[model samples]
Target: MSTETPAVRVTDLTVAYGELPVLWDIDMDVPAGKLMAIMGPNGAGKTTLIKAILGLVPPAAGRVEIHGGLYRDQRHLVGYVPQRGSVDWDFPTTVLDVVMMGRYGALGWFKRPGKRERDQALTALDKVGMADFRARQISQLSGGQQQRVFLARALVQDAQVYFMDEPFQGVDARTELAIVDLLKELRTLGRTVIVVHHDLQTVRDYFDWITLLNVRRIAGGPVDEVFTSENLKLAYGGRVEFLQRQAPCDPPPDAPDLGSYPGRIRP
Candidate 1:
């Protein structure tokens, strides 16, 4: 494992909307080349955390660093995928046009995209299996297809670190699987991928690193180390009954054996 600086770092971070605090003293470090999941219940500031790290929303207090430097110094190295619901689907833009927007950061102020940029966009579309839909209007695509286009846009950015806010929302099972596969592929290519994930059942299956949040940092580390029942209770509170249902244990020895009961039938 590389002992170098983390791909993304946050320290003493605090965010508030008016006088209402959303995040408090948040601190996290995401290692390079790993797939990480930021998990919390609704209104736990998961989206706010990503926005603060990306400098989209100013932090009321604390610092955010990307690859050991300020976010402004490394803006081009970051890719962001906002929530699917955050965008206007009625926009009259083609899929290719949307993906090309990713190159705008590198194009600087107002330069038009050239052949090189087009080719890059096409390649990114292919990466996410959306090459055929390049000419389709954004509003015409299904929910999953639209998500893939946004992902393709991010891919064309060629960022070193990627932040996605609920990319799986409203997506089909196939699209969800595809997104997870793509995240793993990015990790193989040495890029860091962070996702705001809500499903607890898939946390162990999808992420190598996880940070539990509930207005504050509850736990963070490798999945095996930090994704414990105790930490889960702290992060999710009373909603942990699902874990109990999935847990395995023997019934009480004095309990009647269902197998011997006339009402009970074997499968």
Candidate 2:
């Protein structure tokens, strides 16, 4: 086992919506410099897990640590991209303005973002192929374009650990590829990235580590070890009962795939 400190750790974490539980006694360790995915079914608390680690939601029980420290003290080391649906897209903000918000943690309260911050934001936008749309109103962009902006925002943070909620949710195929490329780049740079994902088909291609969750954690580790037919069946329930081979994705009837999906779990 690797003795290095984890980039993110959750210990016996539990979260609730009033009396109803969202996550229960979850424990996970995301190693540094890896791309990890948190995945589960429709109401399985995937997003809730990330939110708890980022401290957006109060945990009813347990603790979370980032780089072996409290999240509040480690804020500068982290960046977050929330679900696009959770944002008020119609709000009056330009693409560049949205990206600049990432600089706020480093800029402190009284100081406004200056040319240096603007340049950083622009460069991050360029990295995501959205530089030309810098001045465009956020609401005018398509779903894919909006997601690109969100990625740029996170990139500009230059954080060592990034937490993203469904970055590929509504993106076009091209945007999905672009995001994947960027994530690969981040991993190469030795940054840790944690994402909440739904498409089981692409999990192997996009992530190095994965945590399978259905309210509580089912399994977590290197994708090859934990993302198995047995673990997937456990997390997804009857949705994968007919998976004859661990290598191909024969999604159950409820998952919107009428036929096979490519990039299935490879043996």
Candidate 3:
């Protein structure tokens, strides 16, 4: 085990909506400077887990700690990119205006952002390749552009830990590659990134650490150690067959063709 402190820790975490439990007892530790993916099938509480960690949803039990302290006490250290579907794209707001919201926490009550915040937001937009669209209305951007703007918002926070929810959901292939490269850059800068990802084929290619979640955490460790056929079977059950097609193994003589599994697990 690594002796270095974890960037994010969830212990005995449980969350429920009224009487229906969404997430069961869960414990996970994400190490610093690593790109981690939280993956599971639909209705597996992947989003709920992110919400709990960010304090957007109240956990019915357990606690979350950031660098060994409560999240509320270290809010400034964290940045969040919610699923794009959660926002109203038609809202009358400019791309730069949305990015500047990342600085609201630092601005505090009644204090408006000035030149410093604008400069920071612009730098963040440039990092995501969206600086040229700063004056454009958010509604005018494509799905991929919108995602990049959200990334810029998180970047402007200058946070040590970032939580992104399904950033590649509706993006083009080029956008996906760009986002992957940005994630790698963040890791290189010693920042920890946790993403809610749905694509199993890209898991091995994109992330070093992974947590297989299904209401509860099935496995959490280095991808090579935990992202095995057996662990995947435990998490996805019958759906494991779809993932087997992408596994790094020679096909058996009787194995079905990869093209047959057209359905993908979306969560």
Candidate 4:
């Protein structure tokens, strides 16, 4: 096993809303510089897991560590992209303003972002192919464009690890390709990324590692090792017979569809 410390670690993590248990004794370790995905059926605590790790939701149990430190102490090393639908798109804000928000963790709230921050935001927007829209209203952008902008925001953070919640949802195929390419580039820079993903067809193609969850971790590790027919059966039960047909153990050149969960980030 690689001896390097994991970029993120979760131990006995459990979360809840009042009494409704969401996660259960979850333990995960994401190696540095790896691209990983978290997958599960809808409302299966997939998003909750990310929230708990980010400290957006209080964990009922267990602890999260980033590079061997608590989340509160490692906030500067992390970035997050929430689900697109969760944000109010109609809010009045410029694209550049959105991207600059990423830098706020490093720059205290009392300090305003200056020219250096503006240039960095532009660079990030350019990286995601949205430089020209810097002055545009955030609400005027297409779903894909907005997603790219959020990714640019995350990139500007220069974080070692990033967590994204369902970034591919409703995005155009071209945007999906762009996002995947950007994620690959992040990996090349020795950054670790944990994505809340759903498409089974793209699991092997888009991520080297994966965690399957159904309110609890069914399996997690290298995609080839844990993304199996048996694990799919366990996590999704009878709901995923359409997926277990292949179950993505051995990758194929073509990506097969998995029920209502459609769309793939082609390699």
TM-score of each: 0.90, 0.91, 0.92, 0.91
Where model 2 places Cα greater than 4 Å from the true spot, the runs are: 239-267
- Per-residue lDDT over 1-267 for candidate 3, one digit per residue giving the tens place of the 0 to 100 score: 468789999999999999999999999999999899999878889999999999999999999999878999989989999999999999999999999999999888999999999999999999889999999999999999999999999998889999999999889889999999999999999999999998776788899999999898999999989988788877876646544455534434454553222234321
Each model's backbone clash number? 0, 0, 0, 0
Cα lDDT for residue 47, candidate 1: 98
| Per-residue lDDT of model 1, residues 144-177, tens digit only | 9999999999998999999999999889879989
C-alpha lDDT (0 to 100) for residue 22 of candidate 2 = 94
Model 3, position 232, has a per-residue lDDT of 81
Residues 1-267, candidate 4: write the lDDT tens digits. Answer: 458889999999999899999999999999999999998777789999999999999999999999999999999999999999998988889999999999988898799998989999999999999999999999999999999999999999999999999999889879998999999999999999999987877777799998889888899999889888778777767544334345455544454542326333221
- The CA lDDT of each predicted structure is 0.87, 0.88, 0.89, 0.88
Candidate no. 3 TM-score? 0.92
Error of 1 at 160 (Å): 0.6
> Residue by residue across 180-238, what tens digits does model 2's lDDT show?
99999999999999999877777777899999999989999998888877888888775
Whole-model lDDT, model 3: 0.89
Q: What does candidate 2 score in Cα RMSD to the true structure?
A: 3.6
Worst 10 residues of 1 by lDDT: 258-267
